[model samples]
Target: MQIQDLPYSDPGVPDARSGPHLLWWLWRNQLGGQLRSLAWGLLHFVSVSALPFCVGLAIQAVVEESGTDLALTGALMLLCGIGIAVGDTFLHRAAVTNWITAAARVQQLLARKAAHLGSALTRRVAAGEVVAVSTGDVEKIGWFVEALSRFTAAAVTVVVACVGLLVYQPALGVVVAVGLPVVALAALPLLPRATRRADLQREKAGRATELASDTVAGLRVLRGIGGEDLFLDRYRRASQEVRHAAVRSARMWSLISAIQVLLPGLLLIAVVWHGIHLARHGRITVGELVTVYSAVMILSYPLRHFEEIAMAYSFSRPSAKRAARVLSLERPTDAGGSREAGVPRGDLYDPATGLLAAEGLLTAVVCGDPDAAGRLAERLGGHPAEPGVSVLLGGVPLDDLPLDSARTAVLVQDKDPVLLSGTLRELLDVPASGAVSAEDALAAAQCEDVLEALVQGSLEAADPMDARITERGRSLSGGQRQRLALARSLVTDPGVLVLDEPTSAVDSHTEARIADGLRRLRTGRTTVVFTSSPLLLDRADRVALVHEGEVLAVGVHRELVATDPRYRAVVTRETEEDPAPAGADRNLTGQGALLGASDKLAEIEESA
Candidate 1:
């Protein structure tokens, strides 16, 4: 494929069986580009080699006192020079095209894999490793792929030149033919040592990259805990290790380079010495001697390619292996199941947790363990703890339906929702069934303050929706970001919505308002919320108390508090208080009093 036709229409399924296999697959896919580069390279190297032959012929013509022969030989030299210039120009163009196209193809495959795997990808691989593969690893793979054609052409040119020399003069030809192979093969012993060092360098670099990424991601937390210097020192040590490994790898490569130059230089001296001896014995002509010397000199250029190709393979092998590992990840699927299509319209049920969120009702789950809560939330949305743990919707197994169908049928908003970098309008521009508008969702999520904060520094006429949000909404307060994420999720208005602690960051007052708004907005939809806040639990049509990995009670919030000690303790974090006096307002005491106190503290904090 050419550079212009890049970003393959379909970046077809990759052959991710092994590193070498993946490399070969890439090469096979871009055979057209490779052949074009190879053809141009062949033309260029052959023309360059022919220049010496032309000069040798011209010297012979001049020595024989043949004017016509001299004119013809001079014309041939000029033609060879033109050929060399034209061939070299296009060879470079083709090789660059191959490199760019190969890299683009690999990048497309990686991007496709990322989309297919979604959040599960980060769980399976390090974020920094993914970054390295997409950026640095891709370029190394492309470099090796692009270098292949040139290496092939160089090898061919060396062979053809050796054959021509043997035909022109056997005495000097035998010396060159024997010495060229030795020059090419002499560096083989050093390659394994260099390759091992390169692998070590790559490993150290990956760790350093991952550490830097993690450190940057948690910079705010590190500063809060006065541990920024600790992480910085750790990164510094990691960087030093990377630098030391790189130096060792470079040293090995430098030795190989030195051998490459030294052995070829020795071969050149040997050929010249042998040629001079043949000339003294009258076994070779001056023209033959000049031609042999020029050919050997020309042969040195191609011989260097052996070292280059070896180095390229050494570096790219590990890169390809990493890329293959990432690409090999497949979405977990159920065995012996035929996937059904279309959005599922039904009650959400998780068999593993025995949690049933009835059709068109808000069901809140209070789990004692946050980790278990998160996993249950995933299961409720069809991403189970293990394959075949069925999460069914509308009497259909969620895993037995197509992924796209299951996703459209249920939308899960994690406790720590990510607000991607973009304008407010773009951030909320999710795929929706058009049952809810952005303004309506924003209002329902109590995001007026967030909208105001986003538009604070903008021009007066600028729309709040047009205001920009920083990466992951880092610029916004925790509550504002959470409200914004809630608004984004509400905009989708899926058949079933699974929210894990959607209001955990907000004040009790805001949470109370959000809980009321969420119930009113999702009145006739299946909504499963994993939370312990009494404000949200009180609003749910039914509340499920999850303890020790299973639901122990399912009832109204007040009934569960009175009867289930486990549920009451988990939610209130206290022993059950005596039942409130008859006809007392529920919001005046106990959990309600604490929630009210929290609201008052939040108001005071805001005022301060």
Candidate 2:
């Protein structure tokens, strides 16, 4: 379908197997607008063609008859000039409208895809690639869309000009007609090379953008570890590689530009030579010869558009492909309905792992492998697993339920929580409509200080909304961000809350408060917190030790340690100095102070 026929301004269809078909679709859909632009552009170019004839006529009129009625010819020339100016204005306006609208439509489609994919987007695609596609690639695609109409108009103008030349003087016309095609088609030969260079440049640019993004994100950690120089060097290397690729692309474009310039000039010279030969033979007047020369010169304007369209298409095809890739990502689906008899009041189960989290009971999972815990958390939250794992909430398979229903029922608080920039109150506000007061949620998450700080954050301003939070809450400490994220989740009051390390950063006092608050706030709710913290585990009614991808033991925190040596070693950090095993669910547990205390106790006992 043409762009005009698209449901939205930009049709971001992902099935790129039919790129030409889609381009045709866009043409058909926006036919009216395209036609309007074409008509205007044609009128403008035809006006240019008329100018040469008018100049020749005016020159002949001046030489042959001093008192001739030049008024009529002069009036025609003035009118054509006015028409060209007016048509050019409207043509550009229509083209720009099409460009901006089409780009916006694509953006809208991408945004919809992002919303549907949710967290899955990051899992499926690189963050940097998405960033590049949205910003730079989109503009490239828009550039092509805007050029299409004008390009068509330019081609039409060239054809009309060539035909006019043929009718005016056959000998000069043949040269005009033949020479124009050579100039317009000159850029076609270089397209393949140009496109290859553009692709290389885009690829390298994407890599560089990714590296820069990664470096920026990890800048704090790099600085902490005194690896800033190393990361900077890596980024510099990536930047240089991108620069090299860009230079290659520029070189190809420069060659194309040279051809565009040379071919048009050569065509004009050949047409002028033929026109002069015709004039010498008394076949055409000297004024007609001048007109032929003027037409050939005028033809250059539209001929340039031919090269531009080629360049635009070469750049846009890949950009559209990139955009399509993002749009093609499928939203996760559940095969069957999970609507059971009860209101989901039972322990969670994962058939893939043969593990059961008992209902109304706090469960602690100690995994020898941290990745195993993260996978378990993903499963427990009804999130799509990396295959071979299925999570069931209240005997209902999570994947079976609609995504919205599943998410509403189960909340997964990630280890690295994202805090959107907003006021403290705004940040605490969540999906559930007024189920829990902000104050209550804050108290439950033990975030009294957080609120106090926020209130104090904008003490001078009359409104709390005036408080400024930097992007990603960079202004806040990691622990504060974590607590705030927890508070937001608590406010949601989901039936099942799967936390991946809820208190890994806070001091013991705050950790204990948070634990108490969670227990009190999440009363009667199925809450599963993935933590190796003694404080959180002690609060759990039962604990499960995961070993070899299985629940080796399931019991209270104390009982699991008493019975399972591996569980004791894993939780107490007796096996390794590090509290978490290699690749353990990120120490999402904010209760590092409790774990630190546990470590000190173990040291004292070992010394004894």
Best candidate (score: lDDT): 1
Q: Which stretches of model 2 miss by more than 4 angstroms?
A: 1-33, 57-70, 331-347, 357-362, 385-390, 394-397, 452-466, 576-608
Q: Which digits, one per residue and each the tens of the lDDT, describe model 2 over residues 1-608?
A: 33455456445454444434434544565567777878888888788778987888887787678446466679889989998999889888888777766666667777877866666787788999998988887777778877888888888888888888788878788887777777777778789999999998899889889888888887778888999999889889988988999899999999989998988788777767777777788988887888889888887888889888888888888888888778777645434455633335577887776777677655667776767777678767766645554577776767666667777777888778788876666776568846677677777777776656666766565444456566677766778778888888888877777888889888766786687778888777778888887788877877777788777788887566555667767777765344444444322333344555655654775699
Worst 10 residues of 2 by lDDT: 582-591
Q: lDDT of all predictions, in order shown? A: 0.87, 0.75
lDDT of 2: 0.75
lDDT of 1 by residue, 1-608 (tens): 67778678987778999999999998998898789889988888998888778878888888898899889988998888888888889889988988898889899999988976666678789999999999999999999999999999999999999898888888888888898898898889999999999999999999999999999888888999999999999999999999999999999999999998998889889888988898899987788788888888887887888999999999999999999999998767533336657886878887777889999999999999998898788777766645657888988987777777878898889888889998999999999989999998999999998888888955642799899888888888888999999999999999999999999999877887798789889989989999999888888899998888778999998788766778878887865574445565545768867656655655886799
The ten-residue window of minimal lDDT in model 1 covers 331-340
lDDT for 3 (candidate 1)? 72
Q: How close is candidate 1 to the true structure, as a TM-score?
A: 0.94
Instruction: For model 1, name the residue pairs that clash.
Output: 346-394
Error of 1 at 491 (Å): 0.9
